[model samples]
Target: MTERESSRYIDATAADWIARLDRGPLTNEEAQALEAWLAGDPRRRGAMLRADALSLLSESAGALAPQFEPTPFAPPAAPPPPGVSRRRMLAWTGVGGLAAASLGVLAITTQPAAAITTGLGEVRLVTLDDGSTVMLNTQSGMRVRYGDTVRRVELLYGEAYFTVVPDQRRPFVVDLPGKPLRAARGTFRVRKLEGKPVDILVDQGGVWLGEAGTADAVLLRANTRLVLPDAAGTPLPVPETISTDHVSRALAWREGKIAFEGDRLDQAAAEFARYSRTRIEIRDPALAGEPVTGLFAASDPAGFGRAVASVFDAKVEQRDGAVILTR
Candidate 1:
């Protein structure tokens, strides 16, 4: 990699895509974006899956688990229509293969796995091809697997909420990399917290939970709960009335928003910084202690700054495209 290109690794926007690809197949839009990226500059595709390079934030994944090929839950479908291939004939034909070879294929495959990409402060839901879904919270990532025997999803990084459609005989399982938070066959939610404890919140038909290395399993009825990576594998407090409001608030990212209710000002600023590309600098540290409340459009940094300013009698300034919050 050239010095310039190497320097830009941390700034690559395709990091998230690479992470998702690590889990499973890309959607039509993702595939096209990746192909266009490949055609634009060959380096993109190779950089994505190559074991050598690590994401800007994750050094451990640099030694990622083996390349687990993605298999669709159903039969392999037909290939793309003929027109699409004809259009890329020139590029694929390699009239200028030698010249473009320098670009490589990494960019096409790699997706971002930055700490800010799927960490605990935000919630994101991804729709799979088969109508099932995956929800990513502030700081979590899972390796996606869908195949003939089982629809397996490995939580490679942090925490994620999964809602799988029941395939009856073919059960859905969620297992942490080195631990256990297993559940077999049902519609439910399981979150694998990195160091704290893995929590299972069963919302539908009965599901089972077992340790990472043992056969000891327990069946959990609806509205069941448990915290694991723990010794006893104790059942946590399952609120008879599960307040999705907290879940919904925690999961605001799926809607491209961040809802705060009198959360500390500093915390609010930190959350806003994640969705925003440009950095945010608070000029007055004291303001960080102030309380903030309301819904903020995550993609709208300017609007958030205005909201803060107008609500708290603060001032917003822009210096070189970065938001400077001051009071």
Candidate 2:
């Protein structure tokens, strides 16, 4: 990496570092120094704050795995002018921003807002200024901010697909605090797993993965998977035989239903509880021990109780809106 890129990495790490420090009491001098560092740049403070949140999300997502894609990973919907977007685009160049600026400055305005997000079970489709689209999945949120120098979207929360317009001049960077940002020059899928790891899958072109310190960046080619953490960033090998088939299944929740193939029964109940307003309680601890794996849609607790009952040969009773299950 060049000196400029090195500084950028440091800038990225600053957020996660400050957040780590904030957990402890700092002396007045330490606090003052921090204030100075934050004030040094227009982007410093915001970057640091985002770093903290990114760390937490990465950690949480890592804890859960297998299938892990949410909604559709679409390209930015807004079209970039006659050329490649980021190697060249950002939200500063989009519809909302384009209206205020000349067509000459369109892509500049739309770049940042390219990273979009959605709420629980809520799927969002966003058009980027470069004409690429993003389909955001449920219970997630993120910020897309493009710049003249770089196309950067801070994955504040959740995941999205980025079909870059293909510009070699500027790279598309997906920023997640505590994790090395995924710099894409082409097309790729980056998903955040709560409490576990960040999964980057490249469909076309490739991506460059780098940490916040002195480390060589890893290049992930097409049809590849790379797992990483936010705080302790690392590029892990994705076995060719172990590609993620679960990404599609995990994302099935966008339409409703979680696909589990012989997953533990208790674990299933906990997941069901998140989607169903009426909790699905397992009265027996051993019930959680039983393995359950299959395709089950998320809906009425009463209905799920029936499904669980039939599958497990267990007892299911509905009290109020909650479904109580036992083996």
Candidate 3:
């Protein structure tokens, strides 16, 4: 295809198609057309997914911005038959809050900055104007600031996985607890657990870790996990290497599950609490260090409680919005 032809159908067209699909069940003709368009170009599918996901997230958050209608692409050579006119096309494609996600995707892309937060047991996916995507885990918050020179994000709390689309001129930087993590092209996960060290896990590409003001930095490559120094500024005794299996286990939360490998019972309980309103308490200190293994739903507090109780024959009590276990 010629360069002009390739550039003719861009993300804006894809976004319009996404808006249409989200509205309602489409006619077979429309459906076939969409499928053909998607199959025609690989990039089109990616654009549609990003736009649709972003719209969903905005809808879920109860904040849909005003509709943004870019200039519609030039109408085809021949107008549609009797019922299906270009006006009908707009009607089918117009932003409808209930029919599908609308307004927010356009707003986020054009706005200078935005902030997002997810409550307990909630996961959010965001598509930035730069075309990067971010998945926010439960109880996480972040602020995005985009400019001509940089695309910046401040991870206020909790964990987020960034799938960055490279922009060589504008570097993507994530601000964590102690240092700034920068990437031009890559996917990575950054986590900030309460009272724990900030963790950076690189799944694809690489990240530069360093203070916000200085030039000194550490380059961490793919499949590597780095745990920064503790609050006391004490580094690890030795460089820690995380295995692929362990990385997968840590990221299991993305799938609404948690993997435990001989994790302390108390520690496991704490992790589960992040995804549920009901808290877990171990009354007996002796049982706090008990080993726990296997995979379980992040929000299944009752199931976890029952499993623990059956294993240790411990007493399980349901208190005011909390679960207490003891022997």
Residue range 105-157, candidate 2, lDDT tens digits: 11111334344445444445444544444445444566777667666666665
TM-score of each: 0.49, 0.55, 0.66
Q: Please tell me which model should have the higher lDDT, number 1 or number 3.
A: 3
lDDT for every model? Answer: 0.50, 0.51, 0.66
Candidate 1: regions farther than 4 A off: 1-131, 135-141, 158-161, 183-242
Candidate 2 vs 3: which has more lDDT: 3
In candidate 3, what are the lDDT values of residues 1-327, reduced to their tens digit?
655435346578877876775566567698668657755654554466555555554543221121211121233587445533322332232211111222112222322356787787877666576557677788888898988999999988999887776677988999866568898777778898788878888866777887544645777787888888876545433225667667667776655667788888999998988888899989999888888776666766666776777777788887898889999
Model 2 spans > 4 angstroms off = 1-117, 183-188, 203-205, 211-215, 230-241, 299-302
Residue 108's lDDT within candidate 2 is 15
Q: Residue 159 deviation, candidate 3, in Å? A: 0.9
- Give me the runs in candidate 3 sitting further than 4 Å from their true place: 1-112, 211-215, 231-239
RMSD of 1: 16.2
